[model samples]
Target: MTRLHTLFLIGMLALLISTPTFALTGRVINQTLNRPEPDIEVSYILHETGDVTVVRDTTDSKGQFILDVPSDPGAEPPPMLFARYNGIDYPGNPAPAGDTVDIPVFETTESDTAISLSSHHILLDAQAGTATYIFIVHNHGDHTYLTGGDHGHGLEIPLPDGVTDFIRAPQGVHLHGTLLVDPRPIIPGNSQTFFTFSIPPSNRIAQRITYPTAGMDLLVQPTDTPVSTTVLRDLGDVTLGTNVFRRFGAEQLAPGTQIDIALSSPETASNLQTPIWIAATSMVVVAILVIYMRTLKTVPNRRTILLEQIADLDERYESGELSEDDYKNRRNALKAEVIDLSDSN
Candidate 1:
């Protein structure tokens, strides 16, 4: 053979050896419209360190892409791939090398169906003059419910006449007087809120919540879901079945109908009247004392002192005494003590 021909064969072999063997192949589809989505951006994210690497090509006309991602030996957990659609990221299953991944996307539209209440739990704390209500709101429609503008007013929940101190609302929801309004849209699926308010002590506390639509499933205590630790005591007319306290309505509620729940807290029970700030400070002090006592019993040393300082730093950061950058730097320095102690041992 000629020398030029031999050289060409050697270069071809080098090119073949350098090319990566594994690849990630995937297709993006609009599940709501039942069609392939073309020219959409897809991302591959490393699981452990949250490092993101983008694919070069968008989906083709057939909504398919093949990405030649070289396998990384340093990546602790295998990376994952997901597609972004309509300002939301839909994640796919853990994609190893040479796997076909398909991502489904949905379109958001305005929904007309009434929101359903899947669960309602009332915890009456007579001792603290507070009654905490938890409502599990579910949207069983194809579209999301937008609260403002032409979408109409959001869900209305009536509070007790003397109710005060609305404790919490869902993240995007706005609280005005007794009404809990969603400032943003309530997306499809299930969303919940734990709202506590102060009420006068009474033998029978009448709690009424008005909904925009009718169908709802009321439960005194969650059956399968482990939500809160507060338990309802002094059951009046409500019947208990097994471990669950459920009240299933036979008919869809009329639009204006008010669902009333009666709760009775024992006379011996005291209301939770202490301010939150006072309670939080007391808990922090108790935790610090307990940790200090334990450290003293365990034998004081540099390692123990470093751990205590780390805990104190975390508490100060949470209480707004330390800035984020300072807290992170100090905490990282303290964690280095772990390595020193390990070496000494």
Candidate 2:
């Protein structure tokens, strides 16, 4: 071989060996066992553009893992690592390449001891006759809640009335008769689950929420949707997605509390054509005040409006939601008008 050719080949081999390899380092700590865990599988997931890459490695005797990930030119490496134990995912802190982090895992349990409800939200689309139920459940205990040891009978999800068919549900959960059985473990922190169902055409629905809620909200879409409930306080209207909804909320409700809601539609076609009744549940108090005052000043023959105001006036009048002086002043005005009309004018 020529001297120059041999020298060139040797130089290329030296450069290849000099380049350093890229790797990620992390450790898995078993909180339940109160020590480091060995022989645990750790995964590193990276998504670049439309392509996804996952690298896996097992922990050593010291509970440490080193994943040798192939570095792409001008690409960024992911900083988070994940470890799964007892069907719950444990995520480590974000660390750059060549840095170390620790992931914590726990043992599994079937007991529902520390399980609590953080928030329960129900979204009802009146126009579509659909009801969607959402729940944010938290496990405050140190161990993960697993249904494995219970012989597939651990968690119970009560079905809302008028549930005809389901549109969406979480994975690892199946419907058994009227109730749903969820086998998925409720991991140590907050976990959210939701289900949507189609109901027959109706204006009323009742559901028995079986969890003790810290905060619960009931929302109905298309602000015009007539929704009223005795269990919750109207919190006015809140915009969600591209539409507006009537919002109701309550705090610290006991388990197995039933929530009943009803809707009303105008009987006549003229009432339907009457521009969307801005008198939603959120504005009921404001509407009552305006109606009582408008009737005192307008024509006296409009007894229908006066009767309507009295019919709709319930606990809201004395419920402290409206100012006491406001209603009293309107009452005086009505008396003055009655006296003037009764005179010879």
Candidate 3:
């Protein structure tokens, strides 16, 4: 090669080294119509520790768009992508930069026939005093299910014998022995909602799956009292970080399938509803809490530790190291610990 050509190639290499770029690329597709959705608005959310950044764009003629995301060394895994259609937000699977993701959206239907629980993870924990049930649900449907009724009762969750506090829900209103989130339309894909209600402290808790759930998993956190379920297939112990949990699994659960979960004996414990964390499995938050819980038991500065952990948890959530579901669950758990610690003092 000529010396002049070598010098030109070196300059191009220098330019590439001096300038760095991270591109988030993807497309929007309509699942119902089986066509690329053009002119739809899309947003790429960057979750960084203690911070969040949103980048917005419109899909082109071919239903594609690209956004330049700044590289963050400390950002959490799976930054989120969203496409809004028909007044609903459809989320693409979270992915890091330099990955292509498809945002799947469906046409809206007032009927609920296609709506079923793709997966349900029930977490029965003795937090504060009440027995709380957290349901993480997904809608495996080709169309968005619009909830319609006189009261918009598209989806209804019945309260067991005794329950209190609406806790948290994606959408709906509660009525008499039933928690109804009216117009809380079920969208296609994972994590449709995370909701909880507290029942009076008791040894046996009856949890009814109100939807025709395809598969379900029950996880009970470690407690002084033993926990077990006769209905679900015993999956044995599953360890998350240092915390060990007794897990059970179920499948083809028809609507109104009731499973009795036996828990600690009845007592009046403080009712603390933690609408914080929501996922069935989150290793990062689990690892973070495992360390935090250790400090809680071992250190004398329990309050100080909790306070610091709470702040740190917020940073992780904001920074994108934690999902909203896991963030909420762990945040509430930590705050509840703080409250209990204060009550003792």
lDDT against the true structure, each candidate? 0.52, 0.61, 0.61
Measured by TM-score, how close is model 2 to the native structure? 0.66
The reply for model 2, stretches above 4 Å from the true place, is: 1-22, 70-80, 149-151, 200-202, 241-243, 266-345
TM-score of each: 0.48, 0.66, 0.61
* Model 3 per-residue lDDT tens digits across residues 1-345: 999999999999998886354777899999899998999999766544445567888999988978776565343333456788876667665456667878877897876666666556665565433333334345556777775533565565666656655554432345634564545556665333444556555656676777788777666665344666767987888765546766788889998788877764534345253333334223323343334334323211233344455666766887898889878776676666557644442
Considering summed lDDT, which 10 consecutive residues are worst modelled in model 1?
224-233
Q: For residues 96-189, could you state the per-residue lDDT of candidate 2 as single tens digits?
A: 5667878878898878878777777777666555566666676778887777732374467777677655665544456767786666666666
Supply every candidate's count of residue pairs whose N, Cα or C atoms clash at under 3 angstroms: 6, 0, 15
What stretches of model 1 exceed 4 Å from their correct place? Answer: 1-25, 39-83, 89-102, 112-114, 123-129, 148-156, 200-257, 261-345
Please report how far candidate 3 places residue 65 from its true position, in Å. 2.5
Residue-level lDDT for 4 in candidate 3: 100
Query: Which of 1 and 2 is the better model by lDDT?
Result: 2
List clashing residue pairs in candidate 2: none
